[model samples]
Target: MEFRVLGPVGVWNRGAEVPLDGAKQRTVLAALLLSGGRALPDSRLCELLWGEHPPATYPAQIYNYVSRLRKYLGPDVDIRRQWSGYMIHPGDGRLDLAEFERLATLGREAQENHRYEEAADAFHAALALWRGPALMNVTEFLARAETHRLAEMRMAVLERRVETDLLLGRYAQLVPELTRLVGEYPLHEKLRCQLMTALFRTERQADALAVYHEGRRVLAEELGVEPGPTLAATFRAILTAEPARTGGPSVVASSWHAVRPAMLPPAIGDFTGRAAELSALAEVLTGDHACAAQVTGMAGIGKTALALFAAHRDRDRFPDGQLYADLGGNRGNAVEPQEVLGWFLRSLGNAEPSIPRGLDERVRLYRSHLAGRRMLVVLDDAADDAQVRPLLPGEAGCRVLVTSRVSLSDLPGAAVVEVGTLGTAEAVDLLAAVVGKRRVANEPAAARRIVRLCGWLSLGIRVAGSRLVARPHWSLAYFAERLADEQYRLDELRLGTLDVRARLDGSYLALASQSQLALRRLALLEVPHFASWATAAVLGVPRRTGDEVTENLVDARMLEVTGTDGGRRQRHRFHDLVRVFAREKADHVDRMAVAASRVLTTAN
Candidate 1:
């Protein structure tokens, strides 16, 4: 028999799992196992199992639990009763916690002996023993009492493993994981220091410095303390471009300190699954060949968030610098390319007086500055290809990641990555992140229905999660029940500035009048998805002109294309949330109302 507490509490006899009944039962077993072969006082077990207030019959309850365990555990595992206290001996059976400790000790000894590879492997093995948070299947009292120590133990092992990987010179491989860790534990100086070193070693001095500055800011805001001496010294090395060989973390090339700008926007902390999209984006952003890719999707589909996430993950890979600009793609007055060029020039250490007045001259000077230097430019919410064109560097070593509602395919040699809504699993994970995991675990079926009602749109899910978070007294079922009403789902999916209606409104208003009419009218058609003929027939226009308007809605991201063959064969539809918004628009607006009524009648 093998007992495990690193994740869910359970016992495996041979290869099959042995049923451990009830949270209280699991708690009793975990409390005893964690006592480390020493007997735990009956009172302590009572407190762990039933909180501070145990009933008068607590001793009897303890006796009943242990007696049940003894019968199930058999003669191989010994449960001893000594002076009104309890202890357990695994005997021939193995306990995962004990094995984890043994492996961690071995890893530490290996590191101390300079066997870094063995150390890394040992630490990896020890960590692999954990499936998730420790004692996760137990009662809240037991989990709360034990999780802190286990979590700290895990973080310590992870830190040591990261150190070993750093010694192995796996800089690129360390970046994505480190970015996530640093985001999670922003207050931890050790993780902050490691991330800085890995970044500088990968030739991202700008990003390394940015990490230090962010840490400094967070420290000041939260605790009113500056960075410690170790972090400060590492910052000095990156800023000075000092080379350290077994001496210091001075890893950047001497010439790189000139103008290392780290201008990536802060990544979404609760950004959930997009494994395939992130992998594809990472390949495009970090690979040898391509330097520019446009991440385009429907409004509020999390295009910007994904772009920033990928950019920050590979920020260290681009050695010279990383630059960012918001071209305000959704705005009526998008930021001009010349204005963005001036900002980039200043970040590159060009004096304001030296910046040329003409757009052509600025582009020349900007490209000239980025000619040989490795850089990552993130142009978020771009208006179009024209707004992004001049901002892009002319060098092969530099990369540009742009996010927009429309496909910026007009940009020469740029790849367009179309982002869709989250899958059911990813959608639930995202909702869980925004709301608490415990709440979702308590009401999983409701959680699934909530994300489904959201049409799996990232913004819709976030907004829905935010609503539940604001109304803490509301149950997941209550929220899911509220969302089931289609007429008010969009309204309920709103909480202080995170309105799905507002997000869709921006994209809707950005469309041409003809496209807007087709969009709102098509919503009146009341179908899940439709082809061009449906739209062409509804709009009372010629097939060719109606097709152009429908395709325009697709290009503008106000509507999603359901088919991919091209020309008249193309099919289009609004996401569930987007359809709701369009229908709401149709009902509210006086001019579109008459046409919408006729379209609805025709469809029926």
Candidate 2:
């Protein structure tokens, strides 16, 4: 019997999930799990469970709960009554919280010795235990407090892991996870700094500087303080082409210095394939003649990953630092260019005392700070030209990589790399990396079918990979069979947190009215790829309107414009995940339209 408390308090007795009945009982179990086998006094338990409102008969209630828990454990359980409180024997029962702590400790130790790979592994193991919020089902004061503490610890561990990964040249894989982490904890300076470093390492100097700037603004506004010296120095290093590794002088004495926060887990998977894309991005960052590079691609086409891989490969070149920003254009609430510039200025060592309050002043300060630095920056998921213009760095020494579902033709001096779906080999390699070579080798046909069903898109491949990993008992053939049905493949692919539907919805919500209508109509067609004429026929619009609408969809990354067929023929297709989401939206919109039409007819 394994008592797991890392998240959702439960017991696994002989591999079956056993629920701990009652809220208070569950809370007690959670407390015990979090305490890591330390004895908790009866008084403390009462206080945590009931706070100041303890019942008059609380002692009896506590005893009763303990007795009930003992009974639930059966004869095998050992709960000793000490003078101060109760203690559970730690044996075979695997408490997730305890395991998390253990792995985190190990990760920290590994990092101290520069065993980054081992540290990353330990961090991954620790993070995997969290299915959701810790002690999610329990509702006692102690449980909630413990849950918060554990969650923070998990974040700290994740931060450390990411730092180690960055040092070990895993920037590309770290960016997505960092993106989410930065969004969730905007005030965490260490994470923001590390994210900047990762972006810089990944050859995104402008984005790295932007991260520092963003952190600076959030810190000042939220906490009324400037960024710490470590971060400021990092910014300076980026600007001055100084080495990032500061070995001799400790910021504080080694023992007295606080432990750096843990790194967030990378967005979800190991880097499987996309070597060619990664290489192209690397050349942009590492070439003798530095230049701005933009990686534009259809949604979920691995642009971010490719850019990240490139940055990680050439992280040492910047040494000053790296920075990254999501731009948030993908989600509709894109950060303004001036706001991003202000953030960059602060990150580049502009103190509130010296920093200009005006947007123009901040832009000048930002450019001045970045003038001589060999930094890397990545503006990820950008909206369009307006969102990206002011954020560009002024110096030729700095490398910038921008990723957008839309092309930024308006941005000057950018060597654009329009990414597309992975070739078959890359897709297959990606799946094999996640699911293991043995499994993929055993079921080659099934593997191909799975990737094909995923449309050779990186995000879709990752989602599919995660699903396979989660259901180890389910054979590849079983998964292939499920995905073989075109009607249900999208539904089957909707597994874990990487919901394809959610990503596509963000794109759909950003569309103009006519383009949205065109997208819905296009979903009605069964063809995998369609021509401009075919799209016009489906939408019942003139060829010119149809062409314009398709172009909008292409720009929005809802559809890919593969090529021109003839004099006026343009080939188009929805990415597999996009198609599924579009179809789902189409059904709902069509139903609503029908209902509205009926109401209008009755009124008439």
- The prediction achieving the highest TM-score against the true structure is 1
RMSD of 2: 27.5
Off-target runs (Cα >4 Å) in candidate 1 are 1-257, 564-568, 587-604
Q: Model 2's lDDT to the true fold?
A: 0.70
Q: lDDT tens string, model 2, 492-531?
A: 7677677666667788888987788777766656566766
Local distance difference test, each candidate: 0.78, 0.70
The list of candidate 2 runs beyond 4 A from truth reads 1-269, 288-290, 352-354, 588-604
Clashes of each: 0, 34
Instruction: Quote the positional error of residue 438 for candidate 1 in Å.
Output: 1.1
lDDT of 1: 0.78
